[model samples]
Target: MNGRSIATSAMLYTVTAATLVFIAAPLLVTMSLSVSDTQFVSFPPRGFTLAWYGKVLRDPDFQSALSFSLWLASFATFGALVLGLPAAFALVRFPVPGGAAIRSLLLSPLIFPVLVTGLGLLQLFSMLGWGSVPVNLLIAHILVTSPYVVRTVSASLMLADITLEEAARTLGASRWRTFRRVTLPQIAPGVAAGGLFAFMVSFDNYPVSMWLADAQNDPMPMFIYRKATGVFDPSVATVSTLLIGLAIVVVLILDRLVGLRRAMGM
Candidate 1:
C-alpha cells in the first residue's frame, strides 16, 4: 500500500481504539468497583471481594424493585408486540392512506424526548384519574417501546417475500395459515429483536418511572438511583454490574435464537 494509505489506516485504527475506550471505560470502572472491599465506590478498587454483590442481592428493597421491573418490562414488551405487529403489517403490506404520515405518528414517541413524554403522560393520566401506578407505567412503557417494535418488524416485513404468501393463498391456504407458516417465520428475528429492545428500554427506564412510580412500586432503575444517591456505596456498582451481566445474557440468548446480525436488521 502507498504511504498515504498506510497513514489513513493507522489513523482509523487509532480513532476506533479511542472510541471503544471512551465507551467501555465507565463500564469497566463500575465492574471493578463492584468487587472492591472499600465501603464506598472507588477507582483502582482495593482488595477484591464479592460481599457487596451479596449485600445488594440480600436487600429486600432491591429484590422488590427487580421483580417489579421484570414484570413491567415483560408486560410492556408483550403490549408493544401486540400493537406493533399489526401496525407493521398494515403499513408494509397494504397501501394504507397516508401510510408515511401514519408511520411517523407511530414512531413519534422515539423522536420526542422521553422525559417530556413522561411528563405529558403524567399530566394526561392525572387528568384521566388513573391512579394505578403499575397500569400507568405499563401504558407509558408500551407507548415508548412500541416504536422500536414497529420499526424493526417493518424492516423485516419489507424484506419478506410477498410471493410466498400469495403462493400459499393460491394453494387454498387461508390468510391466517399463510401468515403463521410463512410470514411469521420470516419476521420472527425482527420480533425477537424488537421484544429485546422493548424489555431493555422498559427495565432501564428512569424518567417515566420517576413520574409514575410510587413508594409501593419502584422499578430497578429508580431503586438503584435512590440507593446510589442515598448511600453512595459499592453495592450500587454491584447492582450496575449485575444489570450489565443480565444484558449480556439476554443478547447471547437472542444471538442463539436468531443470528444477532439478522435480529438487528443487518
Candidate 2:
C-alpha cells in the first residue's frame, strides 16, 4: 500500500480503538466496583468481595422489580409481534387508503419523546378510568415496541420474493396456509430480530415506566435508578453488572438465532 493509504488505515484503527475504549471504560469501572470490598463506590478495589452481589440477590424489592420487568418485557414483545406482523403485511402488500399516513401513525412512537408518551398515556388512562398499573404499563410498552417490529418485518417483506406466495396459491394452498408456510418463514428472522429489540427496549425503558409505574411495583431500570441516585452503594454496581450480563446473553441468543448481520439487514 502507498504511504498515504497506510497512514489513513492506521488513523482509522486508532480512532476505532479509542471509541471502543471510551464506550467500555465506564462499564468496566462499574463491573470492577461491583466486586470491591469497600462500603462505598471506589475506583480500583481496596479489596475484592461478592457481598454486594449477595445483598442485591437477597433484596426483596430488587427481586420484585426484576420479576416485573421480565414479565412486562416478555408480554410487550409478544403483543408487538402479534400486532406488528399484520400491520407490516398490510403496509407492504396492500394499497390501503392513506397508507403513508397510517405508516406514520404506526411509527410515531419511535420519534416521540418517551416522557411525552408516558404523560399522555397517564392522562388518557385517567380519563378512561383505567387504574390498573400492570395493564397500563403493558399497553404503554406494546405501543412503544410495536414500531420496531413493524419496521423490521416490513423491511424483510420488501426483500422477500413475491413469486413463492403466488406459486403456493396456484398449487391449491389457502391464503393463510401460504402465509404460514412461505411468507412467514421468509420473515421469521426479522420477526425474531424485532422481538429481541422490543424486549431490550422494554427492559431498559425508564422514563415511560417512571410515569406509569406504581409505588410498590417498579421496573428494573427505575429500581436501579432509585438505588443509584438515592442511596449510593456498591450494591447498585453489582445489580448493574448482572443486568449487563443479562443483556449480553440476550444479544448472544439473537446472534445465534438470526445471525447478527442478517438481523441488521447487512
Summarize candidate 2's per-residue lDDT along 92-165 as a digit string, tens digits. 99999999999999999999998999999999999999999999999999999999999999999999999999
For each candidate in turn, the TM-score is: 0.98, 0.96
- In order, candidate lDDTs are 0.94, 0.93
Model 1 bad stretches (over 4 Å): none
lDDT of 2: 0.93
* Per-candidate clash tally: 0, 0
Give the number of the best model, judged by TM-score: 1
